[model samples]
Target: MDIDRRLKQLEDSIDENVIDVYDSNYLNIPIKLAYYEIDKYSELVRELNRIRYACKTYEEKELLIKDYIKIYLSSRKMYLRILRNLNNGAVKILYPDNLDEDILYRALKNFKKFDRGKPLNENLNTFMKVKLKQNIQDSNQELFKLKHYPAEYINTFKTYIGSKVLRYRNDLVIYKDAFISETEPHIYSVYFNEKTAEDTKNALLNILAYLNGHPSFYFTENYNFNRKLSELYDQFDLLDMLRLRKKFFFESKEYKEPIFLELPVLKQRCVLKIQITK
Candidate 1:
């Protein structure tokens, strides 16, 4: 693709009215493109300085400068191709339908923010965190409606064990656990569960189905519970695990049993009967 032409197209797609000071929409070009442009310009400046330093004669310097200009332009086009390749890979995963306006801007912004120069999987994990936060916020109402289980049970369980399983739309069960303090809930676990050990895995299957079908469905790559549930789903071993009453401890420590401790909860306190003799 022609880099110059693509840049022109991107510029033309910007909505002037939406480009305000408060929001990032003012950035008519993708953030990645901006970075690329900056890098290319910097390279050009350095090459020009190098030519000036090397050539003593004006004519020789002119020739070198012209040659460097041509080289820079060629390299700029190559840089665009590189950007296109990176953008293409990101689009393949994100699957944004439109690249004309806000969607394009957001897509580029998201990719730029999440695309740490790392392995694809690592970049994907970063992207998922952003998407997950958005999904949770956007679908908050839908999720709240799915919480059919009594609030008493939810509250009590959360207080004691820092976990709550709520029924969602009768067909789905959502499990969320807070690994942090009970007073300040920070959910580290979120996934669907079967109603019973022998029950058909309809709820989880439905969620997977939903996610598969809905490209826009919010996702988090590093969701611990989701990963575990997905593994179980793949193996069809959720029922077996449930039947075995398998317990997972996110944190564990070995300590001596309390029998050796002198303090006992049930032991009565004895008061000395010696009256103060004045």
Candidate 2:
């Protein structure tokens, strides 16, 4: 699919003069903070594209794509944080000047009805007004402290966050496709060893079962013990191996609370060498 070519095309489209546009808008402090975050994210995207283009092997490219996915997820979280803060700041600014709680709550009700698609109910409106008043009071106390920053400094920091958000979204799709193209053929063949394939398959099925609200089986790992019932022992050993593998997957922040079918066989606790997933 010429993924490198697409990446280069996307990289080239990033506007260098986005900050100047933000400066014209005369946005408040929260939006300005968002702009600065966008600048940092853009720089990261540029560097990631550079490294991605340099990859020579399929494995290297796949690893790079995985790293890009991590970066994309993190960037999305950062963007959402900025947006939330900006929304909170907006609510503070739009809050009623009058100190009367009843008056402010009424005003907020009207504001929410017009601004949000689903207006906050009466109970939530009451809570929001209380919180908004507190935030506004806090902002007033801190406003003077922000005056020390020069106009030039703020302008320099007015970077565009939207462009980077779009770029990362595009990059994720492209890189994900590239990763699949590179790895799909060899995923079961080259990646899965005969000794581990059965256990790995069972572990994945167990995880799927849990997701589907079904009970899964667990196996115990017996390292040194040998028994006449070879098949039964082998099944138990596979379960333990699956348990160990599940532990490693759980260590990744991407997979939360990965469920395993079998528990580890505890005899003498020994450390298992955990390999980083590519």
Candidate 3:
């Protein structure tokens, strides 16, 4: 109920050895969130409580709570999405070994986006974060007022922050998967059947300070064609938006076909049987 108590509970729940299920079929599903660190998550809980007791409702409370929700909401939803969308009834998470947080940047050094004709010169190029395409809802406002959706739209693939396997649930998952499509149809998904890297886990918890909203999580920019920013953050379905993560980082080479990266899932058994009427 309180910060320390909750942190204790979370500490209790984490077992780097904890596994979700034995079925190998589900292992391939994860994209990547981050290596999860209970201590880091604990810090967030503490920060939020500090704010709660320190701030009045009219003060930063609303904004802080909003930021607090942003941190945990996606985490709470991840495995649930597997149970909901995928053909599953339960999901389990694990503390990663290296969850290999350092892999992405290293991999990206030689990273060539899946669909792009040119390989990225990491020093000279950045994996642009594409904002989800959107339109003016103001009863078809002036053409100038409409959002400047990228011409590449869905195919504008982005980089993988391995921790994403943890921080984001269905939304980031969808986006990553869609990015996979941008590669080649031969590219398939895979996971570690274990845990992630330490940096990867910590990275997930590190963003807690960005209660104001982290630009790294931006799916689409709010600028119009003229580059003016819009106040509204519109929504887009993954079906409309699109795509997850892994290995191949230890070696220095271009991406090999048929796979994106490997996210690790534990092999221990943890299940919550909730009856649902589908």
Give per-model TM-scores. Answer: 0.19, 0.24, 0.19
Q: Quantify all predictions' global Cα lDDT against the true fold.
A: 0.34, 0.34, 0.29
Clashing pairs in 1: none
**Model 3: per-residue Cα lDDT over 168-226, one tens digit each:** 22111222112211222322122111123434423432332121121123223333421
Clash total of candidate 1: 0
lDDT of 2 by residue, 53-109 (tens): 565544554455444444444444443443454445432222222324343334445
Off by over 4 Å in 2: 1-37, 90-278
lDDT, residue 185, model 1: 36
Question: How does residue 190 of candidate 2 score in lDDT?
Answer: 12
Q: Number of the top candidate by TM-score?
A: 2
Model 1 lDDT-worst window of ten: 152-161
TM-score of 1: 0.19
User: Between prediction 1 and prediction 3, which has the larger lDDT?
Assistant: 1
Model 2 TM-score is: 0.24
Distance from true position, residue 137, model 1, in Å? 39
Error of 3 at 38 (Å): 7.0
